[model samples]
Target: MFNLDQAISAWRRQLAAGGIKTPEVLDELESHLRDDVEQQVRSGTSEEQAFNSATQQIGQTNVLKVEFNKVGLAKWWQLPIKLKGMLIRILGREQPFPFPDLNTFTPRGLQTLELAREEAPRLGHDFIGTEHVLLGLMKSEDGIVLKVLRKAGVDNSAIKAEIERFVGVGPVHEANMAIPYTPRARKALHLAAREANALNHVHISTGHIFLGLLLENEGVAGHVLRNLGVQTETTREAILKDLAGS
Candidate 1:
């Protein structure tokens, strides 16, 4: 006699042993497992079969851990309710931002973030700034930012030249040293989330990031764009149009 509750508990322990240790994350994963098992059982699957299927669908423990880590799972959920509420309000949201448990970044969006981190070091900067993010967006060949720039007849090389000129090389740091985001860069990320929410998009992309840079118009990226003849409103409209058409 296979017991579902015991089986699920054992499965959770396996996940925990495999490094999916955060309580909230474990609870969330268990909830999903239960839902899947319940649905499969309703479809006449045997209890054992349903449990096995659910575990497989939930994915391997190591893979799930990697996915959760990518989204900063622990920090995001550990935020104080009041602070979370304040962030929601700041993003112009009446409700909490959607899918708090899941990563909102598309593949390209994640790549852009990684590239931005790389760009900061390549420029010998100790911190990631909006300028690095701008370079990241441009460097992402599949990003919508490049599409918009091309449509606007703005040269990518020109933008790179401007960023390099404005943000000259700084003292080099150790290659293994962890770089942090500047205040404006952090704000830009928040704005990117807001842009995704406004567009009813579950996943944030390079286009949303570009909009974030535009919204943070006091940043170095904003100044570079302005100097190169990219109007905030017009660029915004163009991005919106492109997204809409796509």
Candidate 2:
């Protein structure tokens, strides 16, 4: 008389709270649970016994959280959007940048994102944020973003060394794991497109991304840049100066 479907649904709810929210992982777990239940039942175990055995074999919630932490699927979606937007505006001393679909990243701009993905794990962070993007830009070595940051006294080695000191060793990112962007990072990207469009530029370039980071000034990336004396207006002017010369 055990309701297997109900039990599974309840288990799923519990799993989600423990950070096992990815549909792919949860679905596979449920499938395996069903198979385990069937096998146990056929071996003369009662329905409830089969269910308990399957649940036990599926592992505890804390263990699953540890196992899946590398996938970078944690609880960042819990942030309050309205408050976040307000804070972003206040921190930057300007209105929040309107959302823009920034689809055009120059080859190097695209490469910057790839570099960000790499930096996220190295920093032991579960999510890719504006800080990671900034780190990525810094890691580029010879790109325009790096050059600008360097010119402004934002020392790469110093920043990297300092930021690492502040953050503790966290979740180890798994290979090929899909990492979700933090809200501010996503907002920064959209603002990058806005920066391009505002300047009548055809392509979203790395310079525009710098503008995005500046505009989305509430994120950790903005904070780090500010600490380095990279104010938004000043950085924007520098980018404009570069754009004008080029």
Candidate 3:
């Protein structure tokens, strides 16, 4: 008695009410829901039962709507499309710039900052993106990158306290500050710059930082990226391919 099509239609309406307005993103979400419902139906559940089960397993649509809204501006994992919009407002033109703050950066993040300075103006942007923030932390002398490094496996405060004992200081820099870069780090910065430019994206996003780290491909930074389940070559290639088609 459960009408699968009816249920999906209702869910789509729910998403729209919650401000998930992009048709493309909605289509992908719908496809996922349909796949879930079909799997439940194939497992011998009645249509109604399958519908109910699939919907429940998918969690509340309202909550998902909230998550989608938070994705671009608030989420640390990915830069929201608002960045592109902001750039458009600034330039008074239609152009896409990546958001920079979303980088899951380590020490190598500083390189991203240098790259941004070199590239942001070229992209005709006045401000940097979240990806740049991530890179700034990594390259900053502010001891943030070190904190992230030590805190990777355990409590961050504990690592800082231990470091203070050796350095006789709270931390080398404040949490929101960026550190200076060395020649080697500068070279890493250039690589990130080149990669961003090659992508033709006006601003950088966290995804770009992932690519930068992969291009660096060394030491602790690379190891952390591997653990994070980032497939550098594959993701880079996929982004490039998508850009090409677009």
Candidate 4:
């Protein structure tokens, strides 16, 4: 008594429990699974056997979760702000949102993130904050971000000094240990992807990252920028101009 519908339902529940909770994503995965099973069945495999083979082909829950997460962020970025908020409310705060893959970032953009990660430990902090991201943007040379900052009369060295002063130094942690992003930092990155998408860019760039930091204007980076007399609108315009030119 192999009940195909019941078995698919059970499989969907398993995926949900394994962190594939988005309804749209779940539906898409289920569709793929069904297609695979149907193909096998058409080729003469028993229905139950086809089901098992399809599940195997779909991949383990953990691997599927990671792949879906990578796709999720891009899809999330395309969502309108209001729709995103509504979806967030429906999903609740208990589930962790998926972040985009670093591979989507351009070389200089990836460098900024890496420098931010390194800056956290160098500053004796165990977590990467928006402030660290600011520092990383400053440290990155020859990037359009630095060019925009220079055009805006913002001194990179001064910004770095200010961030260090604001954050201060925490107790030392192991350099090799992975540091997680603070909520603000994560939001900034999400905004960065959104910024790139708005411009119809396929890859996230350093300028987009800077714009992300600026958009998260209540964060430490925003506070420091304000203290330095840097206007968010002006800086945003400058970054946009640079991006357009390049």
Candidate 5:
């Protein structure tokens, strides 16, 4: 008479040993197992039988471990909450900003730079700044910022639409030369860098960048984000919670 709870507990230990290190992943698998078990019990199966069958259907631990391993291909994708912490510890060494390099930027931070560059011209802005960078953050699929925005009932398309309504159209810039960051936009990015450092974070991420924009409350990006119903404090708190949960 094997105990169902014991069986599940043992299964979890096996998965952990096999390198399914994400608790969320294990939680989801457990959820699936429980669902299967419940269905079996409803059909009059014994609890032990339900547990056994559910475990088997969930598959061998090694196979599932292999599947979970793919999610860690990029170092940042594995544990986003530790992205800054981990990178700052590379080669058994660490450096603070001014000593830090561009290598300290998360993938989404780099993407934000690109998006800001491209979006400036599209929106008829002559320079990249907090507003443009904020828009860029929305374009990223990998960033935590997008998740928060989506949860807030906002998306890139919706934001662009709102911006279009607010700013109408202006003279499109030629792609030959680069436009510069407005003074406020430059200050926003500087603030973003400071924000990351204040958290003792090694890398600048999309969340930090978003926070930077909010900190620049007098900038165009801040105004736009506000119009879109993203309160700085509310979204910042949401981002912190997401990171903690991760």
Candidate 6:
């Protein structure tokens, strides 16, 4: 007889052995396994047959272990925690800001990210980071994030043009070190370097970018979010406090 819970336990053990410790990731994995087993049982297979089939379909746990280690191996979750804390400090408890979704961070979606990196030198900023990226998006006439901000009555053109002009008079470098990001890959890694610089944090973090997005231009992100009817300031603050406590 196939023991569903036992199979789940085994999978968890396998994942843990592979070095994945996040409860959220582990929960998601278990959910997928259960779904696979249930699908097999629904297909006229015996419970034991279903269990065996599901296990096989799941592929080699060792291979999965290796893959997960590659992607989630670092502190990928800390960036946003820092960003939320900064946003709370600025926007307070009632206002809300929406972090750009995965879709919005894509290279295609974030064309301004490249523009921001290139523009940083002109602005006399020694480093190109997320703050510069926020500045970049604000300056870009073609960025969708700018379009969203426009809907909320924020005119970013003045600041955008100013940054461009500043870079025009500043020292320039010939090498291209911009993160090889696609407009479609919303990783926002282009801003990681900047985030680290701004917060004086030991490592490049997502939270700094989050703060960059929030603090740049009188809470431009928060304002745009308010227009969209989402209350981010408080919810994000709570999330920050929770992370800090943990």
The candidate maximizing lDDT is: 4
Give the C-alpha miss distance for residue 224 in model 4, angstroms: 0.8
Instruction: Report the Cα lDDT for candidate 4.
Output: 0.75
TM-score-wise, the better of 3 and 4 is: 4
Q: TM-score for every candidate vs. truth?
A: 0.57, 0.59, 0.35, 0.60, 0.54, 0.31
**Which segments of model 1 are wrong by more than 4 Å?**
1-102, 171-177
The deviation in Å at residue 10 for candidate 1 is 60
Model 6 superposed RMSD (Cα): 18.7
Q: List the residue pairs that clash in candidate 4.
A: none
RMSD of candidate 4 to true structure, Å: 14.3
lDDT per residue (tens digit) for residues 1-246 in model 5: 677778888889999898876676676678768877998999999888898888876678886665445432422212321121122122112212232245777887888777888887776554454667877888775658888888888888877776666545455755424455545556677777887888778888877778777887776677677888987788888876765554
Preferred candidate (lDDT higher): 1 or 6: 1
> Given candidate 3, what's the lDDT at residue 181?
27
Model with the higher lDDT, candidate 4 or 6: 4
Candidate lDDT scores, in order, read 0.72, 0.70, 0.46, 0.75, 0.67, 0.46
**What tens-digit string does per-residue lDDT give for candidate 3 at 169-219?**
211222223322222223344555566678676544334444555565542
Superposed Cα deviation of residue 29, candidate 3 (Å): 1.5
lDDT per residue (tens digit) for residues 13-101 in model 2: 99998887877667767876888799889999988899998888667877766654532223322233222222232233332444344
Write model 6 residue lDDT over 1-246, tens digit each, in one string.
567788678868877777766676666556656776787688877767776776565556675555445432232212222222222222232323333443434343245656666654554333344435656555555433444345445456654544343323334544255322221112344343344444444443233344344534223233343444434454345324432432
RMSD of 1: 15.6
